[model samples]
Target: MVLLSLVASHSDIDLETVAKISADASQVASVVLASASPVAGAITLATCNRYEIYCEVPQSEDVPAARSEVITQIAASTGLSEETISTALISKTETDVIEHLFSVGAGLDSAVIGEREIAGQVRRALNEAQASGTATGSLVRLFQAASRTAKDVGSRTTLGSRGLSVVSVALELATDLSNDADWSTKDIVIFGTGAYAGATMALLRERGAHNVSVYSASGRADAFVASRGGTALDESTLEAALSHADIIIGCSGSDHRLMSSDITSLDRAERPLVAIDLALTHDFDPELGALAGVDLITLESVRMAAPEEQAQSLREARSIVLDAAETFATEQRERAADAAIVALRRHTQQVLESEVEKVRAQHGCTAAAEEVEFAMRRMMRQLLHVPTVRARELAAQGRAGEYIEALETLYGLAVDAPVAPSMKNAAGCPVTGTQSAAAHHDAPMQSPALRQVG
Candidate 1:
């Protein structure tokens, strides 16, 4: 199996930098169908932070050539100039490929500091990529390990702590810079009280913001707000309430901008309105930031203000991924051994049965010594079944090497004309079935990923 990756840094890259030409699934599928892109399983992962394409291609020629074809397909779908898209991404190799994906899953590589939403984004991206016939073998294993590593990383971190949200960080940033420090004097309006919004509110309350008012689309949420000792306002009334609101925090998932229409929207604000937009897709409009009286801070504005660490968790996570990949390599080798033995048993048995039949044909006498000899050989073969069947089972599960090694030593089965079998491995040799390590090595290494951590 072959593995590769496409990565784009935030500087020159646009999410559309990797966005497929097909806005929807059916359109992309049509393109794949037309290209005769020998992809058996495909997956397209697109997000604001990064865009990636992975696929499982059938045996044709080289994997490197196949990699080039996949990137070309992605470029065609996106309508980006070939050079532009190609520049945005770089291929990952060896442990680099596996670890990078794990970082993404772990949310260490998100725009927002420790944003948990990235996990879901990665999952959705993998699902789409798989649908495109771009996922199989190593790519499939890579994603599964990435996802597992991500889960472990998240569980271990203080990521889920209330103080870890972008919203909390935004409020703190705003509070530090803003001269109007009185929580009771400043009217703060919170729009959309989802997890992000909720976390923001908790932070605001911790800052002793007594005059906090929360608004959500659901009317029933007012009681939930009331229980928290904050005034509940209908989200429908947010436009009118903006005049009284000194600071506005928005965490809505709407594609359309909620506030600001030209300079007039901010002209109504009595003070410098601090509007914080904290969505991956940017819930607020960019034009609003240009408004005279509006002090709009969005994901783009703070896109530069990421978690201060160069992702130490990411660095540590890479180490974990490397270790996992190494463990996997060992398992793959052991599996190859099992496969060699199981094939030898099947091949030897076939020759023995055929040769025995031929010898029986030559002896016309029914009760000849040759017939008795044939019967004993047949019984020996039958007796060997006990060990052969066990060895095959172990080989199928990736442990056939020990059994095969023992049998070879016991029976001394040898091919006079010796050549290294065509088994795929670190050496890049292709081995034939039964003669090679297909059942043994491939089977043991066949699992999507070995769970090294919870």
Candidate 2:
């Protein structure tokens, strides 16, 4: 199956639009799979600043239709107009999809570059897809490769040396905004009990923040705090926690936004309160930033404030991602010739079996007959090995069509060649011709951009 990715991220759109689309990410895969589209499988990766759907379709030609189907499903699920959704997303197929996902998993595309949290998010996305039975083998391999690429980048480069992340940057901004720069002196309250919340908690502890309270709208706070070392707040105690909190971090992205009025109504201390909203769909309303005695830190603000990594480190990381993408694409291309190779081997095996059966019939399974059969089998293997190797070589060079044609012409072996996903340039021209691999390797990598769908 061909890989297609529909991406809406902080680079191409505002965070508000990203949040709106991400709100229904959990359901997008199921909706797409249940539809009449040619999509064989799908995996959704929804984060604070990005929402991506990776799909597996039957053929390269089905990509446009599959893209349309996914966009329609996303629009339907997210209550967005098709045109709006299409405008927000960039369509990626073949190697572009591979490179994009690798870059993302390695945090090259994050608002806070080189953040490690996205790697875990990428792994979890595949796991979630597998659990839902919506991830096909091709998509699974793609994601696994992404994970490996992420690890390679992390280990080989100093890109993440500071352990930077959205949460870490927000906390850094919070430290700057707080009256006391020391995290231990600040009374912190974290909203939501998911992965982001857990990450925030760990970072806070690293910064020596001990006076922390956890609150979850879905009653998960108790269990979350039990394992994570925080005081759990129920609905009745939430307002009091808010009032007492000197620093409030939101990771929940819950439907119930903490409005300015919610905090204003509370008899909060007149001291400075640094409110960090790390959620994509904000847990705190934007108006909260305007409140007296409060300073807001958001994903957008964090993006602006995030420190740039060393230029050499960034280049090293990107090179790793590019190399990984090329290797993955080459392997996938080689796999495209598998059907042809299998057909050739099957044809050879049939001939060998027929000749061996004649030997057995003529010699009544004698030792001489066995010797003849063994020699014939060895000769057949020796003959097939070169063609098998050539098939893979031809496929990787984007000449699988030629290999399949040769098989058909020589042996009357009408093998159904597997369709490899075709690469396209930003202008929508196919790049999978015989020179595609060489051209792609020589060309500089470009950022994924909007490819508007009709």
Candidate 3:
């Protein structure tokens, strides 16, 4: 079966709606399982930013047609325009499949640069696919190799060192407040445990601000309490702390301002209050800014702040990813060649026997008949030897996807070679794969963006 991958990322698609569309994990898994012909393996990797379907299918079925069916399901689930999904769906043939999977495992295709989270996500996804018994033989091996490479790359390098995702211009603007103004010995309290909050916390720490407390209405108190370095102060406690804090980082989801002085009973203090609201809605009470010694920073004002420059170290990390992508593509081509050569040898053997038998029948059973057959076999092997060698050698080259495709075509071996089954099929259905969803319970993914809340 050939590996097919569809990429849907960076388009102007509704992200939350896409998540909702992909929420029916069972249906998505079933479709993926059903799509792969001869049941090699199937997996659907999705997040708010991207959704992809990978499958092993026989060369016969129309690939684009199968992918379109998946697109319909995705659109139906998410309520997105079907045309958009169709337009965005991407497909790769032969070694491109392996290259894509490796790139994904390596986080080259991730929304966040050098995102460490994608590795665990991919591992869990492969584990599910394998458990469903849909993932068998070569598919299982390919995925394992990809996962191993990811682990190796991550462990060896400082690839995701920042861990801090550089988001929209808003958070960077908030960062400027620390540099533009000096708030030493200031109580910089974080309200809401969102991604923005975490960023503010890290920045606050960088600025030598002590008493950095994090408060959230929806956030877990236990997590906050154990946040050790970060105080897990609740909204009630947050308001009380606000009076004494020099910088108040607001990250709650309340429709109304939770920063009102009346709520906190802020006694007019000599210290200046810099309240940075990072929530979608205004979290801090507007009146709090009206109080003496208070400066309220809203999202609009945050957006107005200058953008942060890319760090040199992070840029270097990006180079590492690019190098890894090239290396992965090279490895894929070599393996594809190897598979093609195996297919070629089988086809050649069939042709050789047929031609030799025809010659023997036409010439009649004479001593010369056996000699002619031997010479014919030798000649055929010699004629085909160079092509076979070239096919394998070409496969080992770096970034040789196009070459691999050409070699497969030239050798008359279809790129989508059916993999032999190592284990018997558990499902009775005519499957390219088994129709099973990820049956195991994995911990729900916490929004990396949520870590930004303050």
Candidate 4:
């Protein structure tokens, strides 16, 4: 199966479009699973700012046709027109796909470059695909390599050092706004109780904000607040909290706006209301920022204000990502070469065994015959060593497909190379060369614009 990728990320698309596409990750996964032919398997990774479908298609299928089908499915799920999706999507094949995955895992593709959350997201996508039995061996290996690369980058570089993330950036803005006043005296109200909410709560506490209230749009406020040591407010009290609060943090994960025209119009405190909306869908009405006593910081603004790494550091991190991707591709090629080497060895051993048995039958099973059998085995082993090593070397050198074809032609061995299969399918019958060999080099992917929220 050949690797293909379809991507819609914040870098190339607007937030509105991205939100629509990412509304349901599961539905996107379903579309990918159903539309592709002989889908060796597929993984759909949907996050706040990106929605990508990675598919493994049998080489026999029309690649362009399959890509069209997947784009059609995405349009169906996201209510987007096919023309729009076709125009907006970023497509990658073969090694380009590998490089993109590695970059994403390393957080080099994220809007907040070096953000650590994408590594977990990539892992979760792989896990979910595996659970559904859609992930094949190639994908498993690719994603594992990605995860390892990300961790390596984190350990080897300062990419993840210094509190970095949308949350941290928002908090920095909050602290800046609260500079004139003591953080301990401010009444902070946070919307939503998901991971973002928890993270915000923790950071707020670290800044000495003792008076905290949480509103759960999903009705988990009680549990969320209890765990985080904050008072849980119900919908009825939302307006009151909004009016009196010194600070408002939005991460409700709700599609509906938290601050409507009526809520923001209410009069009161002299201290300006500092609103930080970290959610992708935008938790508050953007118009609320126009009010006289409110300072609103949003994902876009935070992303704009995000710190940029020194050029040298960025170059180093990118070098790490590229190196990891090359290593993974080489490993996969080596693995693909293994099948032929194994088959050749097995055929040689069988021939030697048959010859040894014939000699024993002809001469009597004597000590001399045994010695002859041992000699024959040793000679065969020595004869096969050079070719076996060369085949592996060729595979590592990106000539795997050529060597495999040569082995098949020379030995008259019908080679069926296996695609990445779960352990259950590891011993699947040999496949012939009808399918095209894996590509040695992928097209260079265009450098996506500065990382966006995805």
Candidate 4 regions with alpha-carbon error over 4 angstroms: 60-62, 178-181, 265-271, 422-454
User: Is 1 or 2 the stronger prediction by lDDT?
Assistant: 2
Per TM-score, the best of the predicted structures is: 2
lDDT of 1 by residue, 1-454 (tens): 3344556634346543333322232234324433544443445565544655554443325456656665576667656666765666676654465566666667656666556666766676666544433334455566777677667666665453343445655776676557655665778887665656666677777777877777766554587586566777774666666777778877754444564572264336355677887654555666666766667776555566655544565566556656666655444334444444444555566667777676677875567847676776788678767775676566446455456556557655431211112223344332222323234445443222111111
Q: For candidate 2, lDDT tens digit of each residue in 166-203?
A: 99888878777764668787789999999999999999
lDDT of 3 by residue, 1-454 (tens): 4566776543434443344445453355455444433434556776435566676555436576657667777777656677866766676655677767776776555545555556766776677666555554556666776777676656666665555332323334444544544445567677666544655566666656667777667756448546647677765676667667666666654444564655346664566656776554456765766766566776445334523325663455445545654665556556656555555556677788998889888987888888988998898789779867777567665323454466455654453442434223345342323322222123242211101111
How far is 245's C-alpha from truth in model 4 (Å)?
A: 2.2
lDDT: worst 10-residue window of model 2 = 445-454
Off by over 4 Å in 2: 417-454
lDDT of 1: 0.56
In terms of lDDT, the poorest run of 10 residues in model 1 is 445-454
> Please, what are the lDDT tens digits per residue for candidate 4 over residues 234-282?
8798778777888888887586576557554666655578889887778
Error of 2 at 298 (Å): 0.7
Using lDDT as the measure, the top candidate is 2
- Indicate the residue-level lDDT of 443 in model 3: 27
TM-score of 4: 0.85
Give the per-residue Cα lDDT of candidate 2 at 291.
88
Query: Cα RMSD to native, each candidate?
Result: 11.2, 9.8, 11.9, 9.2
The full ranking of all candidates by TM-score, starting with the best, is 2, 4, 1, 3
